[model samples]
Target chain A: MHQKIGERFDGRVLDGGAPDGMQTFLVEPDLIVEVCRFLKEDPELRFDFLADVCGVDHYPEENRFEVVYHLYSIPFIMRARLKCRAGDPPKVPTVTGVWRTANWHERETYDMYGIQFDGHPDLRRIYMWEEFEGFPMRKDFPLKGYKDAYNPFGEDIDAGGRDD
Target chain B: MTDVTILTENKKPGGGSKEVLLNLGPQHPSTHGVLRLVLEMKGEIVSRIDPFIGYLHRGTEKLAEDFTYTQIFPLTDRLDYVCPPSNNLGYAMAVEKLLGIEAPIRAQYIRVMMAELARISGHLLITGALPMDLGAMTVLLYTMREREMVMDLLEMISGVRMHTSFCRVGGVREDLPEGFTERVAEFCKVFPQRIADYERLIAKNRVFLKRTKDVGVISPELAIDMGLSGPNLRASGVDWDIRRDSPYEIYDRLDFNVIVRDGGDCYGRWDCRMEEMRESTRIIEQCMRDMPEGPFQVDLPQVAFPVDKELLQRSMETQIHHFELSAYGFKVPKGEVYVAIEAPKGELGYYIISDGSEKPFRMKVRAPSFVNLQALLGGATNMNYLADVIAMLGSLDPVLAEVDK
Candidate 1:
């Protein structure tokens, strides 16, 4: 299936070597929507289920973020991962038009990694507050959260806490 | 934003009939846990439903990055708190895949047994609670009573009723306690009667049928496109089940039918879960009969913790191996894998990326509740009566913890 998809797309599909038995493809961010549509519409390769969409932030890498998509083809009984790199304030075309479930997944990706989906219907923070300052999932973000933004409910709430 | 604005442009020409915006929850009992729905109502019917989640978000994915693979099991437990063992199994399988090791056959059978029990417990809650939400109070009491039996089995095995982090990377934490199989057999024997009781109460009741029969209809195509899984997807007449389609553990050896209903409504969803509980019982019975006798966990000194403390003290090599494994977790090869199991609610998947470190580089959970809940926006709730919205929400069975994870 990977070879067939690769041959079909020819120039668009970059051969991403299989890692940990996962058939991965690195496609250009611009071609993702088209590629996804092909994966869904093609009779032989009907990758119908968009299992998940998530983002990974590689702090020191040039292309800071990678949007990972897990697609499962029920008919074919095959699974593949599509990955595309995006720069800071990462922008990728939304696949919501292809898979409706992408609406929430893309929003979640946007919320956690600050990756903007270009054509998403309602792209906003799905997990964090709308006015949340920085992408919490980014490696650069501190695990304890921003100190300046911290406002405890009250001193009484912290009174019974362990000092250590 | 444009959608919200369009929805609020209420006044029609001539006589003004304005649309009223109603906030359903974040606290309302019917919305489940911390899920707030902004309903655009034109009179009594809901025009648009904007579901706002994230109230239960604990950033489990982000938190997994800072913890070792072994330490992340407890975190997975909290994703779908109702079925923690299922979540644990999914995560453990992903990590085990990364590490390139398989658990023993006995351990696999035990995992199957535990997962099926978790499925039954989760379904019992949904089957009972959804009817209760629709005003069948007796169903809740009956279902809770039965669910307690399954909880007792869990508590006996893992020593925890809810978050049974019993599954480890290579296998289960410990072997099934003495007479565990007998207790399971007893539950399996009595479960059918309880199910029949539930069926008698609501399955044919005229009021129950009226409320759920044609409400929240999701066509097969829409259900698939929306990535609905487990019973919700099955209710739409989609014959895709990870247990049967993509067999994991000992599911391939187990004989049980996948319950599917074509109604694609609240009743269909409810029926599918009820039937699935019966199927789960069958699977548990088969597991008990066919369970192999061997080591419960694999003998990977580096990956699996030594079960016997006496061996560590008796042998120098064993002590050093245990010390090293405890002090520093095992490293996985630099790669990634996405392993999913047919969780009680739906497809609970763990996508793990290992950068040759003890801790995962990135962990993404494909929570079924999160995806299945999207069906509400896809078409399930649009133009439906406000009352039907609760029935639809109940049918979808969204666990806010899984959604917000």
Candidate 2:
């Protein structure tokens, strides 16, 4: 699987060694859409099912955030993970065109981590309301949530507990 | 974001069929929970349907960052309260994967039994509730009566009816309660007859037949394209069940059929869940017989409390170990893993990334209802009446708590 995708994308496909028995790969942000399209359309690697897409907020790291896609091949009964790292203004090209299931999953990733999906048709907040302030899933966000009309006091997160 | 305006030269204000925007809920009962759907209706048929969710959002993933792994189990129970044990099992398995440990064989058996029982209980509610929307409330009363039996068994083992919170990071809270197996065995035996009663009442009924048969057909390709799972995917003729294909825990050892239907209609989805109830019964019966006598929880003291009561009471070292483990939760290895189980609704998954700390770095739930809820959009609800839309939504069975989570 690695050699096949590697030959196509060359240096773009970086193997993210199998963790917990899951085969993971780190793809360049620019190539993710094309790569996902190939994985879905290709006969052998027919990863037709986009199981989930979620964001990971790696605050204090060089690449601050990551957009992770969990793909599954229904016919082959195989699973693979794709990760794309994003910087300060986290943005990754949308795979909505490749797999329609990416529509909601990408919307959710944007809503949670405030990571923008470039070219996503309906890129709007999912779980949170439109006017909600900060992304609650970010590492810097307080655990008690933002203070609004409903919640007067957010949370007293200690200075030491902010980072690891 | 395309808004199509009719430029017909009828020339009269408010003449011809005008598009009416109808808001179905954030409060309506038939929606099952707090879900608001904006329906663009032209005369009687819906032109488009947009589902506005998050009315029940509690930000469980955000809350999980501060809480320890042990503290996160209860939050999972709230996602799909109909089947709390399944949520518990998925979360427990994810945490165990991170910690690089497996629960005892006996505990795996216990988890499978509870999960299948949870499947049965959940199927009963939806199988009944779908018909209830069509003015068949008696089936709900009957199905709920059966659901209570499954709940009684869970309460017997875990001592809680809805949110048991019985699953620990490594394994279950305790062994099966006395007489619990006997009660479940009895339920497994009599439950098939109860299901037949429901099938007879609704399956051949003329009203039920007309309304559900080929009403909301989702093609196999579209079902996979939308990432549907469990009975929803199976009903679309996709023979995929995470328990069977992925073989999580001892499911590979268990013998049960993955119910599949080629009909791909509202009736097929309903009938698929009905057949699954029987499969779940078979699974529960198998777990009861094959379950071996062994430790319920893993022996690892870091993840679970010391198993021996005598050692816990007599030894100060053991007590101190317990205090430190509980008070300041033990650290897990730094890594990330996503573990999905074939839950009643679909694939209930927990993706956890640990920074080698007591609390997880990031925890994301790939909630089945959240993804499956998207199917209500597109042609599934479009061009259908308000009544048929409700039937379609009911067939999908999206739990709002999980959807908004």
Candidate 3:
């Protein structure tokens, strides 16, 4: 099923030797919406399900950040992933127009890693407030969240007990 | 920054310039963990909902990159604190996939048993707490009682009630303890009756039904499109279940039905999970009966610690393998694998990228709670009463630990 759809989009299979056994496919960001639409509408490739939307930062490397979409086909019992690299402002074409679930997932990707999903309707931060300064999940973001003295866990327990 | 002015204008003002932006958490209960929900509210009815997560972000992924394969096992436990064992299994399964090694039959059976038990506990947390969120405090005690038994069983097997890093790469860390079967049998024998008691206590209760029945209604197609999984998706009448459909571990060898209800409401979500607890008990019983006798771990001296006494005592080579496995974890071949399991909430998958190093290149967690939590905005909050928001949140039962991580 992936092969049939991959052919339609001219998607190239990643080197099988890639780490984690992820069968990476490079889909044109523009064609992503159409490809996804076809995948959902096509009978053989009814990937009517969107599993997850996540962004990975490959900093100091070739690709700055890659937005990955995990799709599952119930009828075919197959899974496929689509990826696109966003270098500067970290943007990927939103699939929310195709899958409503992408509304929050794409927002989460944007919230955590500062990736902008173009054409995402209501692209507000899903897991972060509007005032949050920077993306928390970026490799550059510090692990300690918001270095102010106020400890949320301090109300339930002491501040010093929890450790690194 | 370009869109800042547009956002500000659209931000519905709460009470004409006196709009108090109240930070509900980073410590609030409804936020689940340390999620800070910035509510621009006039009173009880919220004007706007801005959920701020990452308060509990421990950088486990970055830590995994620095640590060895074995060292990352314990870290997965913290992701979904409600179901640590499931996270442990998911991580172990991903690593094992990279190494192209399947655990022994007995080990697989034990892993299933542990995972099922964890599923029941996770459901109990949601089921019991949903009522608590609805002001039915008595149900919390009853559900906690059931959860206690599960914790005790976990302690018996893994030596910790929570965050039991019992699951290893090849198999579990320790064998099932003596009389573990009989104890499990005792629980199973009485479990069905307990489930009935719970059903009567809340399933048809007037207040419970009213708060949940039509509240948080998520359509099947919408749920699937939104990436919802586990009981939430099951409530919407989607017959997709990782355990039944995909069948990893020893799940295929057992007989159990995926509990599904078509209401797609908060009550339906609750019903699906309540039925799931019963089904999980059945799976545990089947596991006990079908468990085979064999080596617990795989025969990989490089990854798994060798048990041969002669090698440790007489041969230096055998001792070196054991020392290396413990001190400097084995390197998984350069491969990327996405392995998922039917967790209590949904399809929990671990995507591990290993470049033939002691540390992983990139590790991504397909957390169910994170995906399911999106229902708060679309299904529950936008269409229901303000109080229904709490009921729906509790019903969705997202462990913010998983979401924030």
Candidate 4:
């Protein structure tokens, strides 16, 4: 089924049968939005679900934050993924209009990695507090940010305690 | 910020004019962990709610980046915390995909047994806790008792009751202990009847029905659109299960029903999870019957560790391979992979990218709890009262630890 869909879109059968089944693709990054529309609405490939949207920060190299999407076609029992690198304040066309689920996911990706999804309905931080600085998920972001003490459990403790 | 319930409930008595701000937890009983919800209340109705998370961000993902594929097992146990075996399985399956290896038949069966037991444990928590949120503490206690048995079974196998890092990248760390099967069988036999007892306790109880039925309603269309998975999606009448659809490990060969309900409400969700526990028992019994004997871990020299010190000390080749593998780690081919499983919460997935390095270039978790957490405001707003907000929260089952991670 992936092969047929891949062929129709003039996309290569990148994975699975080709010893690379783990990462399958159907469209190039430039044509991603259109390909996603087809995948979501096409009669044969009704992948009405947007399972996840995340950004991978490739540090050490500039201009490399790839936004990946995982889509599932319920009826056909097939899955496909799309990847796009957002350079600078990096932006990808929003899929929130297609999948409401993308709303929070895109926000999270933006909040964590500072990868913006252009035209996202409410592209605000959903997990982190409003005044928190920097994208915590970025490779460069200090693990503890700027907190005096790292208390994941929210216990009250002085910062001078033994550091593990 | 005033409690949403307080404002909503006191609106008429306060002449519908008072504005209140109340904070709910980082310590509240029903808020589920250290989550702070600042609610603006007009009497007893919540005008707006601002949720502040990150009280449990342990930087597990960041920590995963520094650890080897084999070393991340203990970290995965801490993510969901409630269902560590499922986490172990998801991460192991992702690593297996990268390694291009599958577990042995016996290993797969054992994975199934442990995962299903974890599922039952998770369901018991949600079931009992949801009821407890609605003022049924006794039912919660009963559910915990059953959960304790499941945890005991896990402890017997892995030496840790809750966060057992038994699952390994290639397969499992150790084989099932003697009489482990018998203990699982005993739990399986006793569980269904206990589940029935739980059902009798609240299934048709008027208050439970009143609190849950038609409350926190999410339609099938909305459920799918919102990326909900597992029993939450199943409860909404979508017959989508990763085990059936995607078929990871030995789940393809296993026979079990995908439970669904037409009504996508709290009650429906409860019913689906209840049915799932029963279905899980069936899978466990089948696994016990079909369990086979074979090597537990993959046979790849570069991937798996030396079984004993004898091999490591005596064999020069083994030592070299171990040193090389441990220092450089086993290299996964250059590519990307997303392997998802029907975690107790929903479709738990691991999206990994490899540049042919031992360490993953990028690792993104497709956590169902995080995605499902979005629907809370949409589902709870205007449809239910302030008290129903807690019930609605109970329904969404967001683990802040996972969400903030």
The numbered model that scores best in lDDT is 1
> Tens digits of per-residue lDDT for model 4 on B53-170?
6778776777777677777888888878898999899999888887778888888888888999899988999999999999878889999999999999999999999889998777
What's the ranking of the predictions by DockQ, best on top?
2, 1, 4, 3
Q: How would you class the docking of model 4? A: medium
Mind giving the per-residue lDDT tens digits that candidate 3 earns over A1-164? 55676577564433222344344566656677887798788987788888877778775576578887788887677777777777576667889888887877788788778888888877777655566666766665544554444533222323322221
Collision pairs in model 2: none
> lDDT rank, highest first?
1, 2, 4, 3
Model 1 DockQ reads: 0.73
**How much is B177 displaced in model 4, in angstroms?**
0.8
Q: What global local distance difference test value does model 4 have? A: 0.80
C-alpha lDDT of residue A16 in model 1: 84
lDDT values for all models: 0.89, 0.88, 0.79, 0.80
Q: What is the TM-score of chain B alone in each candidate?
A: 0.95, 0.96, 0.92, 0.93
Candidate 3 local Cα displacement, residue A54, angstroms? 2.1
Per-residue lDDT tens digits for candidate 2, residues B285-324, read 9999999999989888777898897998899988988999
* Per-residue alpha-carbon lDDT of candidate 1 for residues B1-405, written as tens digits (9 for 90 to 100): 544455456544632367778887888888889999999887667888899999999999999999988899999999999989999999989998988899999999999999999998999988988988888888989999999999999999999999999999999999999988789889999999999999998899888888899888999988998999999999999998999988999899999999999989999999999999999999999999999899989898888878787897788988887777778777888888999999999999899888998899999999999999998884763327888988999999999999998
Give the higher-TM-score candidate: 1 or 2: 2
| lDDT, residue B134, model 2 | 83
lDDT by residue for model 3 over B1-405, one digit each (tens)? 423343365456653444445565666566556666665644445566666666666667667777899988789998888888989989999899889999999999998999999999999888888888788888879989988999999999998999999888999887899999999999999878988998889888999988888887888888887788999999989988988887888888899998889988889889898889898999999999989888889888899886455778888877899888878889889867788888888989887767798888788888898888777655442343457677777888889888867
Question: Distance (Å) between predicted and true CA of B325, model 1?
Answer: 2.1
Model 1 chain B: weakest 10-residue lDDT segment is B7-16
